[model samples]
Target: MDMAQRETWTSRVGFIFAAVGSAVGLGNIWSFPFQTASNGGAAFLVVYLLAVFLIGFPTMLIEFVIGRRSKQNAVSAFSELGYGNWTFAGVIGVFASFITLSFYSVVGGWVLNYIVGSVTGGYLGDASTFFGSVSSGTVAVAAHAVFMAITIAIVAGGVADGIERATKFMIPAILVLLAGLAVWGSTLSGASAGYAYYLSPDFGVIATNFTSIVPSAMGQAFFTLSLGFGVMVAYASYLGRDDSLPGDSAIIVVLNTIVALLAGFAVFPILAATDALTGSTGAGTAFVALAGAFGQLPAGRIIGFVFFVVLLFAALSSSISLLEAPASYVVDSYDTERWKVAVGVGVVAFLLGIVPAYGYVGLFNDFVFNILLPIAVLFIALFAGWIYGGEAVDELGRGTSLGRGAMTAWLWWVRVVVPIVVAYTLWLGVTNFYAGLVNGAYF
Candidate 1:
């Protein structure tokens, strides 16, 4: 009986593209390639695919359920659903949003710098040396400030005109440029070698790598799609109950998966063809390998322009969503003004972003994808499974026959299976993260 749902998108396509835009950023482009390489490419892909179906879909439905049910942002949604302790989960969404956006904006800054550099032909030389020259101190800080400003400006402008309009441009550009790059990459001299490295299977590696791979793959699936920590909940707060939650979530999940798969096609071939596949193996893998590939292109400058432009846009699209998670709570629950919410969140998040804006970018990035995301997702699953309880199934399954049947089994799996697995992975990630500090490990 809440009367607070915001007006949603005008069309299905617009909504779908927005979700895809959120899901398809560096997680797919930068993170996925390196992850695929480190974990046996095709074998890890198999495990990843399985994890997406088993854990990702159900969990997504869970968040959407919470969002739609309460018809409010994360905090209000939780409190509105019933009362008491659950409201704290909504606040957690705000905290997670801040932590996630801090590092994300830094990486986004790198994407912007690359686009500018690409257009300027800065990557036309030896990659290893050029990459060493591009990171940190001045360049990173400058780009970081520029990207953060863009995020803040957009948030300050309000959601529909700012977020929606920007995403419409960025999402299509990302897809078109990526597809073009993949096609061009396939035509390169050694493209097959890269394709083989990417697509070839190695069962033995998967067997030995499975323990570590579980946490990594699980983290990727959740973070790439912006699941777990009430992002979907916040987004769904814009919807009406007449629209089916489960049906909507299905479309969202499918489109997001397509974007992720498309990214692999766009990036891996270029790396293999340029003999830069090995470059993605280390600390500067993204800068070294990707810049090297762009440098080798016939008109690497133009390609770099398009590639990083799309990456910058992708990061912005996702960052807006991250910011909205908290802003929505403030604006919706407390009746805060949109302008105040925007500036307050932006100023606060910008200050916190400084921590990861410098030398700790990669480590913080790993901690986000590897640790924070999984923990948030586990809570979301439990909320859908136990907190929302049978109401989750009813809420999700209200419109379509497929949705009704789909919700039943997914609920059980989330309730019983996913939490145990996620909790175990969280333990491993935390322990390994601590061990790295104790042993001076940097991977």
Candidate 2:
């Protein structure tokens, strides 16, 4: 854990791939499509895209600036920058990462289940029933543990050897498989309706449902990009002074967005073709509706296998980043060996994940995504814009081609825009959660 011995990304491309790997995961493939479907399709898509640029991008730059400036884990990074009081923000980030991964690993387990089910046709007949059976029983618990174990093994390998190497391979494989699925999906009989739903916004829906739509859109935007939780901060800590934060951030955002769009193209078309679009509204959309679509396709067994494999890769790529956020905190703080800390974190996460594996996924997901995530982001925005302020701009500008004007603009956005927008969204989320509680709906 010596400063000089700390592992840096071997190359810029390697670092970008790893960052994109973290960004483009179940958040995109699983959550994005479902959130879009439930939140007014293209209306949600439009708001989500705006949130990505307006909020997510600026907040991501804040994380990178903090990480690269401190060269420490998220929690210690503030203290390293002589702002120890703001370490509370970093603590929220660490907690978010830990809690996010607990339920996240459970979904990774679902992907694993489908990968095998694809081959055995286990989910072919009644996709909903199959999902119910596998989603919450002892089988789900075992799969969650297995997924966490894989994540721990990769993270134990250290940054360059484990995360960078795995992502270098996994990201390309995910893109290729997803692209192929999109192409095939385009040929489905009712694909145009899917395309319309995904791409054509209904302004009336947005006007009528603005309150509900914005919160979900903003949350999805942050979730898909791995924002709010310091995953990016931990990743950026490994960056060298010569790496361009602006360039890297842009590339990561663009690539991640493209992959998300491709997933929509791949998913919605299939659902439309199979008349299963109505079912694409919950956590089980991919496992149930999409799996059902696959069951009805030509050569479905092979296609289904490939699709699940892609999902598995996406899940691992992001899950490692999530695990690494807290694992890096422990490694940086306690000087524990990376492998030992990785195992410890993995074990605890697996144990804590049992609730979600037992079918409390919606509760956990609501708490983490809607509530915890926005609060974390709000803290980050305040620190970057207020506490860190000028120093953050200097840090962002250090290794990048961004001029003073651009950096200033970014700083102001973080200071004014991000805080206001995130606060409003946080209010919405809290209100919704309270309403759900009063109505006994979340259970």
Candidate 3:
């Protein structure tokens, strides 16, 4: 916990790779493709790009400022940055990271299950039923616990030995597998339909629902990038030098965006070919459709194994980052034992995984995605926007010209637009929660 030395990145490459690893999770591959298709095709992409540029960048700057300025984890970083009252923002951040990884472990568990099944050639038989059982009930819970355990083990190792070392391999492996899948999927007969559904923007469809799409775009923008969580601030706080935050930020964004685009190449073709493109394309879409494709295709089991392995890497990378936010918080704040915080969080995450393993699965997903996530992010934006003020902007543009020119305007946008959108999303999350529960609305 003696981060007083100011953590330096093992390399600039390591820094970019770690950030990209954080950004390119199930959010990009599992959620983005279907969410885009379900929302309004290319229109969703357009809105998403705008969100990334207008809000995501500034918010990232904000987190970087807080992290670098305090040179501490979320808790200490927030309290150290400004007035005592503003420290609440730090608390909210640590809590958000905690909540995020809780259910995420459940999904991570599902990925692990698929990985095992792929090795066993389970997908060679019945894809639908196999993926179905994996999605719900007690089996899913067990898998989640296992995933959390793996995540905790990595986080316990601390920065250099744990998170950095793991990402070095996982990120490259993930990229390789995803590339292979995208290439294979392109050879399918229905790949064109999938590509059309993915890339062809329908303005008419978008025009009909601009209001809803704007908010969806904004939320996806922030959440997908993992900005405003104090997670980035936590990571940046470890830095010893203020290299090119602008160039670094842009590299992370492009890597994440390309991965998301490649995900469509990997997912949509299989879905269209298998004829599983149905319903609202919920969180379960990737789990169902891809598993189905793996079952039916020749050499299906091996492909399934590759998919799940890639997924496991994605989940682990992200889950590690999520745990790091909170564990770092505890380590920095009380000078508590780092291993104690890591073990403590892992145990809690293990228990929390149960919520999504049973009847409350949908509720667990909605609660985190809808409630805690947006609220935590909202406070993060507010802190960076009003409390940390211009310092956040200066943190980004410290040693570069692009940083200097863009930092002021970016700060202005974060101060003006970002918090307002976060607040609105928080409200929407509440409404969605009630509707999903009382009204029995399909989430």
Candidate 4:
């Protein structure tokens, strides 16, 4: 599609919904709570919130400026703006999106199986065994393919008709269902204990593990907001100059944080009430502990069904954006039809996903989260802050009413602060990955 003929969001609200959908996914509901609980509880939460505002928000604004200014896909955005070699940063984003979706779709498949298992009571007998059975092997591969197909179909429909329309319904449904779940969870017998564990900070843990905590918190902020990858850039590409990047970015961050907190409210209480809080982190939290907790409830099956349905929606919403990063790149670079590109990308992702589906999720997860994502985001910070500094500020000021002073402040923050912090985080991530390898952690 030509630049003028390129599809744009039908409305700002639609764009916001789509962008929020991209952000609020398994990262919020699945990863955020578990990461927070595992990494010093409220101590981690404090760092995560700071990272969101200081690092994530600024980087997001830079991405929006880049996309809206160039009116192109993530990869083409840089070159379109006359930054020839810096397009490499966009390529990293596209690659990160592709790799992320490979493992992510496998997890999405797990959600699909849970949705079915909830209705059939397949997991009631032994949640661990059921998750194990569905998480790998032929069943897992089949489910992964099914989830990828759904994502491809949505992307093939194009932005306005497909992505925006789907998110408008899905995002609201996720929020409403999550709120209801949180309310019900608050009534559980051990609700106070759960809240205490989640909300009360352990300052000593942070003091002792500050290095590890900061990186983990930074990664969670990036993951939950769908930053680091080109999803935000590609989504922003569909935006018009009339949309206020700062306003929309604040809304996205705030809503995403709310969803993450609500997920904690909904999950921790149930785990505490059922005494299933032990080993309730990572994938085990969702499939094993929570599934088993549901089995012990009065209307276990019904609640389980609703919870997994919400999870499925969250998974699909994020997955489509991941696929779109690469799809947009291919479409913009090669001028291919969207449907064909979607199918092609889906096939490759399914094939790449099989290794994880066949029981290697930890490997893929470590690579993407600890290695690829930090590198991608680091490059984005450098590009936005240094390479395209003044131009980025100019682009950011286009739609909003911010004065030159505010814009200049943002430019300096992105240029100096973001890159330095991101670089340090990237170094920590690399070292952690190597340490994990030395300790045989991923095996």
Candidate 5:
């Protein structure tokens, strides 16, 4: 099929849901609150919002332009937009997506396990033991296969029938579920403390932790938006050029932020009310601490069921995007059928995921999130700001209402500010990884 004959999003709303589906994933729910909590709570949220609007928003628009203008997948989009070797950025993006899904599906599998366990009372005992049991061996592999199959099924359905349709329902379902959870959680006795902890700014802490916290906030901003890995480019590739890149970006950003904040509100209150370890973060926070909270909360079983269902949907929403990045690239760059591309890439990603699922989870997480992703993002920024340059701005401004001043500001942010901040974050991640390696501290 000719690139020009490719399927497009049926409507602007579908496109927005698809994009929001990509951005609102495990990171938004499981990761964002932890990052905020560890980095000075409300203070970190302020910085993260700044990074989102100033850095993430413009960069996202650039990706949208790259995809819609080219009407191609990530690798092909770059080749269509720029000169030779620019496609290498797309290659990196594709590779990063594969690595991301490998571990991502492992976590997705865990979510599936928890969903089943919540109903059957399987995780009602020691959270650590349950997590340990679920994270490896035959159980992990089986769960991962199930998760990947679901992701592949969606990707195989093509654009309108699959990605967009699924997200249109799933995103709204998540909002409703989280909203209900938040409202219920607010009635808990200690909910006020949770809100205070999440929203109160400690200026002294922010000042003292400024240097360390900025990287976290920036990383969260980038990751929460699902940038740096060609996911957005692939999603945007299906968009009609008439779509407003800036407006769509705003909608996606707002949806992602709200979901993240809602997750924090819902989880933190339950944690506070139950006296689950408020200091914890990451997988443990989501799995263990949150599971413990569910056991103690009123209607605990029902709450656990709803929370894990939301978690599974959130993970699946993002996993499909991760799978799509490489699948779309293969279909576009190799002229393969979408189903074959999806199955082949998905099986390979599943096999690769087993290694992380068995063990080395932390190592894989660090290498991908802290290193490969940031590097991919940096290249994207440089490619758009320097290589694509004026053409990129023209694409962004096309069929949109962005004035010259807005375009100029967006250009400057993408070209100058994004690269510099991303570079610093990448550097910090590299240094930290190395330091952990030397001290035998990294997993």
Candidate 6:
């Protein structure tokens, strides 16, 4: 298939929803709250907002320009841009997407189990024990297969009818449901405490843990925005030239942040009301802590059902994007049929997912979240800021309202500032991983 023959987003609304769907995923629902809870609450939110605007926006624009300009998959985008070695950046992105989907589907399966349990009153027990039972063995694998099957069905529809149509409904439904949850959460008896814990800034904590908090904030910003994985690049390949890259990027960031913040509001109040906060983070926070909270609520069954349904939507919206990146690559690079490529990618990702589904979620997450993701973003910043340089500015300016001075400033930030910060964060991830290995006696 020729590049020109590729499908474009049906409209700007479709593009925005598709892009936001990619950005707003499990990270927003599962990871963001725990991250905020562990890393200074509102203090972390402050730093995270800074990271989103300063680091996230610039790097996002870089991906948008590259994808829109090349109208190719991530790998071929770099390759077509005359950066042969830089093609590794796209390769890193595709691999990262695969690694991410591997463990991501595992977590998705966990969420799926919770959804079933919530509806069937099966979650009326010890939350920790329940999570443990569902997280591994045959049940986990079965749930993972079901989740991947739904994701593949959407991806196989190709760009317009599949991704765009699905996200159009999914994103709006997610927002509406989340808003309802937030309202209900605020009405809980302990809502005040939850709000205070989530919104009350502690400068003392930020000052004392500057090094730790900043890196966490930066990583969360990158993760929630789905950067460094060629997702934005793949989504943007279907973008029309008339769309404003900067404007669309800003809208995606804002919508994603809203969803993340609302998740905190919806979850924290319920946790506080039920005394189930427990200082937990990560998968345990969502599955165990929140599950326990739901079990203790007045109309516990109904709330649990709705909450898990929201999670399912968030997970599916994001998972499809993850699958789309590599599937897009296979179709564009191999000149293969889209449906065939989608199915092939789905099967391979499913097989790989079994590794993490069985119990390696931590290891898979460590590789993708802590390492590959940051490094991929760093490479993108280097390419945009250094290699692509002025041409990138022209691309950003193309079909948009950016004036000469504005474009120049955007270019400078992408080339100079964003790279320096991302490189520093990348170094932090590398050293942290090394230290973990050494401490564990694996090195």
Top model number, TM-score: 2
Q: Total backbone clashes of model 2? A: 0
Query: Which TM-score value belongs to model 3?
Result: 0.93
Write one digit per residue (lDDT tens) for candidate 2, span 136-191: 98999999989999999999999999999999999999999999999999999999
- Which parts of model 6 have CA positions greater than 4 angstroms off? 438-443
Candidate 5's residue-wise lDDT over 101-140, tens digit each? 9988988998999988898887877777888889888899
Question: Which candidate would rank higher by TM-score, 4 or 6?
Answer: 4
Q: Whole-model lDDT, candidate 6?
A: 0.86
lDDT of 3: 0.75
Go through the candidates in order and give each one's C-alpha lDDT: 0.74, 0.90, 0.75, 0.88, 0.84, 0.86
lDDT of 4: 0.88
lDDT of 2 at 247: 87
Candidate achieving higher TM-score, 3 or 4: 4
Full-model lDDT, candidate 2: 0.90
lDDT of 1 by residue, 324-429 (tens): 8888777776777677787788778767767666567667766766677777877777887887879878887766566545667788889999898889878877
Error of 5 at 224 (Å): 1.6
Q: What is the TM-score of each predicted model, taking all chains together?
A: 0.93, 0.98, 0.93, 0.98, 0.96, 0.97
User: Which predicted model would earn the best lDDT?
Assistant: 2
Cα distance off (Å), candidate 5, residue 438: 2.3
After aligning candidate 3 to the native by TM-score, how far in Å is the CA of 98 from where it should be? 0.9
- Write down the TM-score for model 1: 0.93
Q: Provide the lDDT at 421 for model 2.
A: 96
lDDT tens digits, residue span 222-283, model 3: 66687645678778876656577777788888787888788778887887788764347666
Ranking by TM-score: 2, 4, 6, 5, 1, 3
Candidate 1: C-alpha RMSD to true structure equals 2.3
Which prediction has more favorable TM-score, 4 or 5? 4
- Report the lDDT of model 2 for residue 227: 89
